[model samples]
Target: MNTIKTDVAIIGAGSAGLSAYRAAKAAGAAAILIEGGAHGTTCARVGCMPSKLLIAAAEAAHHAMHTDAFGVHIEGTVRIDGREVMARVKSERDRFVGFVVAGVDAMPGADKLSGYARFIDDNLLQVGEHTRVHAKSVVIATGSSPVMPAMYRALGNRAVVNDDVFSWDDLPKRVAVIGAGVIGLELGQALARLGVRVSVLGARGRVGPLTDPEVRNYAERVFSEAFRFEPRAQVQAAVRDVDEVRLRYVSGADELVEDTFDYVLVAAGRKPNVAGLALHNTSLELDANGLPVYDASTLQAGAHPVFIAGDANGVLPLLHEAADEGRGAGTNAARYPNVEPVERRAPISIAFTDPGIAMVGARHVDLTAESFVTGEVSFEDQGRSRVMLRNRGLMHVYVDRASRRFVGAEWIGPEAEHIAHLLAWALQMKLTIDEMLRMPFYHPVVEEGLRTALREAEVKLR
Candidate 1:
C-alpha cells in the first residue's frame, strides 16, 4: 500500500472541496483532494446549469406560444423537438463541465486522487483500497446526491432522478414530478412549457417553502399557469410498468389521484454523502439527517481537527453557500487546533421557476410583529413588469422597528434573483431602511419595485 502525508486531506472535488483546496494552497499548506465521481461540480453537470438550459428552451417555446398576446402572429406553428433540445443542452453542459475539470487538473501543489476516501481514524484517511493518507487536519466536502426514495428505487430504470434527467437524449411525453421543491418545480415547468404533460406532486402546502401566506397564494396562482401542482399531496403507492410509471396518491382535497406517466422524476430532497466516509471511525457525531454536526461559522467538527463543508454539512445547499463554506473550512482547517473567529454572511436563496421566488436574510416565520415591522409591494401593476408581460408576483420587506434595520425581504417577482442579491448585501452591511432609501432607484426598472416596498417599510417603522 502507498502511504502519503499532507497538511490537509480534502475529500470530494465539487464546489466546496475545490474552494477548500485552493484556500489550503494559499494558506501555504499541502493539500490532497480525492474525488470518487466525475470532476464537474453539481451546478455545472446536473443541478443548476442543465436546469437553466432546459428552462431557456422552455422560455423560447413559451414566447412563441404566447405571441398572440403580444400582437405578433406566428407565420406557422411553433414546434419543440425534444431530441434537438437535449442535444443543445448536453452540448453546452459538456463545455461548462470541461472548464471546471480543466481547472481542477491544473491545480498547483495539490495531489488529486481519483478514488473513494474514508476515515481510518482521526487525522488518518484512507483512499480507496491502495493508498493511506496521513493528515494533520481533514476537510470533508463531499457533495450531495438526489434522494432516491425506496419507492422509486423499487421502480428501477423507470424512476429518473436529477442525475439521469439531464443525460437523456429525449424526454418522455408525460412526466410526473414528485416534490415541488426547486428541482421538481423547475424541471416540471420546463417540461410543461415544452409541451410535456407535467404534474408537480408537492409534499408541502405550497411550492418551495414559501412562508408568507400572501406570497404563497400569489406563487401558486402564478405558477399554476405553467403546470399542474398538487401542494398537499400524500403518495400512497407507485407502480412501474414496461412502458410507464403509475402513482397512487391522495390529494390535499382528499381525492384519490391515480396517475400514469411515461417517466417519474423524484426530487424529494438530498442527503449528505457521509455514509461512505466512515465518520464512525472518528468521534464525529451525525445529525438526524445523517449530516456531520459542525459549527456554522468555523466549519469545525467539535475538537476533532475535522471540518465539514458544502452539502455534507446539511445546512444551506446552494452552490454559492457551498463555495463560501469550503473556503471557510480550508481557512479553519489550516489553523486547526488554534481556533479563531470567522464571520458568515446572511442567508439567501432562489428558485428558477417562472416569475421565480427569492428570500434574503430572515424569513417571515422568523420574525414577529412586535420585533419587526413589515412592508409589501404588488408587481401586478408595476411599470417595467407591464412591458415585459411577466408581471406576476408580490414582495415583502421585514424591518427592525426599533433600530430601523433592514432585516430581510421575500418575493415572487420578476428579476427575483437580482433583487435578492441586493437585499443580501444590504442585510450584510446592516443597512437601515432610511439609508437604503437614500440610494438611487432606477426608474421604469425592476428595482423601482424595491423602492415601493422600502417606502412602505419606512412608513410602518414609524
Candidate 2:
C-alpha cells in the first residue's frame, strides 16, 4: 500500500473541498485533495450553471411568444429545437466545468488522490485499494446526492434526476417534477416555458423556502400560472408502463390523482454523502438524520480534529453557504494546534425561478408578531413592475420591534434576490430599520419595492 502524508486532507473535490484546499494553503498548511468523482463542482456541472443556461433559453422563448404587450409584432411563432437547446446547455456547462478542472490540474500541492476515501480513524484515511493518507487534520466536504425515491427508480431511464436532466439530448414532451423545492421548481418552470407540459407534485403547497405563511401562499399563487402544481400531494406509488411513467398520488383533500408522464424528474431532496467515508471508524456519532455531530459555526466535529462542511453537513444546500463553511473548516483545520472557531455568515438563499424567490436571515417561522413586527409591499401597484409587465409580487420585512434591528426577510416577487441581498447585508451588519429605510430609494425600479416594504416596517416598529 502507498502512503501519503499532508498537513490537511480534503475529502471530495467539489466546491467545498476545493475551497478548503485553497484556504488551507492560504493558511500556510500543506494540503492534499482527494476525489472519487468529477472535479467540477455540482453548481458548475449540473446545479447552477447548466440549470441557468436552460432557464435563459426558456426565458428567451417565453419573451418572444409574449411580446404583444410591448406593441411588438412578429409574423412567426417562437419555437425551441429541443436537441439544439440541450446541446448548447451542455456545451456551456462543459466550458464552465473545464475552467474548474483545469485549475485543479495545475494546482501544485500534496498529491491529489484519485479514488474513494474511507476513514481509518480520526486523522487517517484509506484511498481506494492501495493508498493510505495520513494528515494532521481532515475536512469532510463530501457533498450530497439527489434523492430519487426507490419507487421512482423502477422507471429506469424514463425518470430523471438533476444529473441526468442536464445531460439529456432532448427533453420529453411532458414532465412531472416530484418535488416543489428549488431544483424542481426551476427546472419544471423552465421546461414549461419551453413548451413542455410540466407538473409539480409535493406534500406541501409552499413554493421556495418561504417560512412565512403569507409569503408562501402568495408565491404559490404566482407560480401556479406557470406549471400544474399538486399542492399537499402525497405520492404513494410509481411504476413504469412501457415508455411512460405512472404516478399515483393523493391530493390535498384526499382525492386520488393518477397521471402518466413522459418523463418523471425526481427533485425530492438530497442526502449527505457520508456512508462511504466510514464515519463509524472514528468516534463521531451521527444524529437521527444520519449526520455526524458538528458545530456549524466552527465546522468542528465534537472535540475531534475532524471537521465537516458543505452539503455533507446537511444544514443548507446553497452554493454560497457551502463555500463559506469550507473556509471556516479550513481555518480551523490549519489552526488545529490552537484551534479557534470562526464566526458564521448570516443565512441567505435564492431560488432562481421566475418571480425569483429569496429568503434571508431569520425566518418568520422562528419569530412571533409580539416580539417582531412585519412590513410588506405589493408589487401589484409598483411602477417598475407595471412597465415590465411583471406587475405581480409580494415582499415582507421582519424586524425586532423593540430593538428595531433588521433581523430577516422573505419575499416572492420580481427581483426578490436583490431585495434579499440588500436586507441580508443590512441585517448582517446589525443595521436598524431606520438605517435601511434611509438608504436611497430610486424611482421606476424594482428596488423601490424594497424601500416601500422597509418604510412600512419602520413605521410599525416605532
Candidate 3:
C-alpha cells in the first residue's frame, strides 16, 4: 500500500468535510480529504435545495387553488403534472449538485482520496485498499444517514426516505409519512398541497422541532387541519403487499385504522455515520451513543488530536451549524496542541412548512418556568396577516425575569422563517426585551406581530 503523510486527514467529503479541508489548508496544514461516496453535499443533493424546490412547487399549486379567498376565481380546475413537477425538481437539484461537484473537482488530486477511511490508530488511517495515511491530526465530518426503523424495513422497496423522494419520476397518489419532525412536516405538507393524499404519523405529540407545549399544540392543530396528521399515532404494524404498503395504527379517536399507500416515507430521523469508522481503534473517549466526546467550542475529541464535527458529532445537524463545526474542527486539528476555542453562534432551526415552525436560541424545554417569563402573540389578529388573508400563527417569546434579556422563542406562524432570523440576532447580541422593543417596528407588517410579542414579554418582565 502507498503511504501518504499529512498534517490533517479529514474523513467524508460532504458539507462539513469540505469546510474542514478548506479550513485546514488555510491554516497552513497539508490535508487529505477522503470520501466513500459521490462528491455532492447532502444539502445540494437531497436536502435543503431539492426539498425547497419541491416545496416551491407545492406552494405554487397551493396558492393557485386557494386564491378564491382573495376574490380571484379561476375559469377551471387547476392541474398539477406530476412528471413535470418532478422533472423541474430533479433538474434544479442536479444544477445545485453540479456547482458543489465543480468546487471539489478544482481541488488538487493529491489532496483528495476516493475511498472510505478507517482509523488504524490515533495518527494513522487506512484508506481502502490502496493507501495508508499518516497525519498529525484528524477530523471526522462523516455526516449522517437517514434512519429507517425496524418495522419500516418490512415494507421493502415500498418504503422510502427523503433522499428517495427527490429521485422519484412522479408523485405517488398516496404517501404515509412517518415522524412529524422537520422532514416529515415539510414533505408531508408539501405533498398534501400538491394534491397527493398524505397521512403524517408521529410518535409523541411533537410537531416539527417545537417543544413549547402551546406552540407545539398550535402547530399540530394547524398541520392536522391541513392534512391527515396523527401525532401520538399507535402504529401496530407495517408490511408490503404487492406494489403498495399497508399500515395499521390506532387513531386518536381509539379506532383502528388500516390504510394502504403507494409508498411509506420513513423520516424518523438521522443517525450519525460513525459506526464504520473504527473509532474504537483510537484513544478518544466516546459517549454512551459511541460518539466521540468532544468540546462543542473546540471540536476536539477529549485530549487527543482527533476532532469530530457536523452530523457525525450529532450536535446541531443544520447545514450552517455543520459548516461552523467543520471549520472549528479542521482548524483545531491543524493547530493540535495549540487549539483555541471557537465562539459558537446562537442555536436556531426552522421548518419550512407553510405557517412555518421555528426555534431560536434556547428552547422552551431548556428554560425553567421560575427563571423566565413568557410573552405571547396570536397572528389571527395581526394587522398585516389579516390583510394577506394568512392570519394563522402563534408566537411565544421567553425573557429572563431578572435580567429582562431576550433568551429564546418558539412559534408557529406566517413568516416564521424570516421572523426567526431577527430573533436569533437579538439572542446573539444578548439584547434585553426592552432594548429589542426599542428597535423600529414597521407599520402593518408580519414583523409587527413579533413586536407585539416583544411588548407582551416586556409587560411580563416587570
Provide the TM-score for each candidate, comma-separated. 0.97, 0.97, 0.99
Per-residue lDDT for 351 in model 3?
97
Tens digit of per-residue lDDT, candidate 1, span 257-314 = 9989988899889888999988788878777766667777688887788998998877
lDDT (10s digit) by residue, model 2, range 1-462: 999889999999988898888899899998999999888999999889999999999989988888888999788877789999999999999999999999999987455889999999998999999999999999999999999777888889988898999889997898889888888889989999988999888777757688889988888887777788876799988889899988899987798988889999999889999989988888887788767898766888888888899999988887888888888888789889567676667788898888889888898998875998888999898999989988888888888988899888888888877877777788789999888777888777999888888888887866
TM-score of 1: 0.97
Point to the candidate with the largest lDDT: 3
Which candidate do you rate higher for TM-score, 2 or 3?
Answer: 3
lDDT of 1: 0.88
User: Mind giving the per-residue lDDT tens digits that candidate 3 earns over 3-109?
Assistant: 99999999999989999999999999999999988989999999999999999999999889888888999989999999999999999999999999999999999
Candidate 2: residue 193 lDDT (0-100): 92
Q: How far out, in Å, is residue 394 in model 3? A: 0.3
Write down the worst ten-residue block by lDDT for model 2.
337-346
